[model samples]
Target: MTLTQRQARMLADMTTPTPTQHAIQVRGLTKSFKDVEVLRGVDLDVPPGSIYALLGSNGAGKTTTIRILATLLRPDGGTAVVNGHDVTTQAHDVRASISLTGQFAAVDEILTGRENLTLVARLRHLPNPGAIADDMLARFSLTDAGNRRAGTYSGGMRRRLDIAMSLVGNPPIVFLDEPTTGLDPQARLEVWAAVRELAARGTTVLLTTQHLDEAEQLADRIAILHEGRILVDGTLAELKQLLPAATVEYVEKQPTLEDVFLTLVGAPTGAPTPTPAKETR
Candidate 1:
């Protein structure tokens, strides 16, 4: 094609709307820490407004991938685009388009839950920080405990608050790095609800978790990362199809240990019980 014709076609292609666009895209992503390589040619595409779980065992480089996409760490090789901005070149734009919630809750123990939310709001220079905090508290079902010190929050409640804080600016994408780690089964369930709410509200969530069930329950699509490469990527049903079909067998269904534990403790479904009032970080 002539150069002029090629330019016109390119412009037309750019103007045309795609049925769907990836919220996060990684191509041949590679990262190395000193002598030991961490990520080796990882590729992922997370659809907008869906939960994409990156499942892997320990040392699988999940966190490394997240850090690269979040612009917190530079990848040694390859390209990662988050929210349509290249992480390496358009780092500022990428940062503006996403939030990162690490494994642990980053709450200020001394601050009340309300205070913590407002603190993040103010840091982001959002308008009416108090109102924003209140709305977030209500949205995350933390309104009842809004005035309580974060130190007194149960593990699940704290995680909810932490995630709420991340949504202060309404960034289009969020990276949750093992958000349920170290939480009790009840607490994990609590966080799971929050995650569901995020996807429901049109937020793209890229969740990294080692827990197999977490991926099964939360992800619209799952990608298994091992030794820095994605082994398989698909919906739960699609992934399950990789193995041979199960034989026809009838067995009595048994209650899972987690089910019995939650039932025994009388865990509330609406919310997790808070830590004791006397408990402090």
Candidate 2:
């Protein structure tokens, strides 16, 4: 078939790969607080529609990394790109394409669940804020408690609402920084379900978790950070392979006291569980 110049141009455009396609791309990310160098050099690639967990102990630069990616804090060195926009140079554009749900719920205790979402929609200047609020309330199962003040909500409920509010603009990438830190076992499970749902629905989630089990349970890939550097990054099975071969040792199969306690309490160390009056995911 003989094609005109316009047809050839259209075909080329259709086949071209987007230059800014990754959900997140960070190279040699570094940060310094006064004289202390927290993140010496770090690099990461988070693909679209996946859950990537950053695991680290306290002061391991997990929060710093999230802050830089979310455009909340500027990096002293390196580069971070979110949804094809440089976080430093295109801070506004990057922020417009992402949401950051911090360690604590950023809900307004004074407003009801519906009101909170409505306020966010209005702030973003979306069309029909009331409709969006109600729709979000329903989507997160907060319809029943939509009228109740946020202060009356449980820990899990607050966290759900907090996350739901972040989705008001429906950005493709979400940043969760130690989201379940202070929640009870059941509450943690609920949040885990929510995180799973987010990734399943094609939202790229970059979460920082202190608990090893949490990373194993929810992350499609995990990165272990120490002293501002990634010690390892891979799937759980891949990481396990990196460990030395198991040594032969005699051991009982009986559950330990902690195991029994956990089983009886119905809360597995991390990930998520528990029912709230209103669930949000």
**Which candidate leads the pack in lDDT?**
1
- Span of 10 residues, lowest total lDDT, candidate 1: 272-281
Compared with the true structure, what per-residue lDDT tens digits does model 2 show for residues 99-121? 99999999999999999999999
Clashing residue pairs in candidate 1 are none
Model 1: residue 209 alpha-carbon error in angstroms: 0.5
Residue 253 alpha-carbon offset, candidate 1, angstroms: 1.7
lDDT of each: 0.88, 0.85
lDDT of 1 by residue, 214-273 (tens): 999899988899999987777787666555578876555565677668767866565444
Model 1, residue 54: displacement in angstroms?
0.2
Looking at model 2, residue 46 earns an lDDT score of 84
Candidate 2: global Cα-lDDT?
A: 0.85
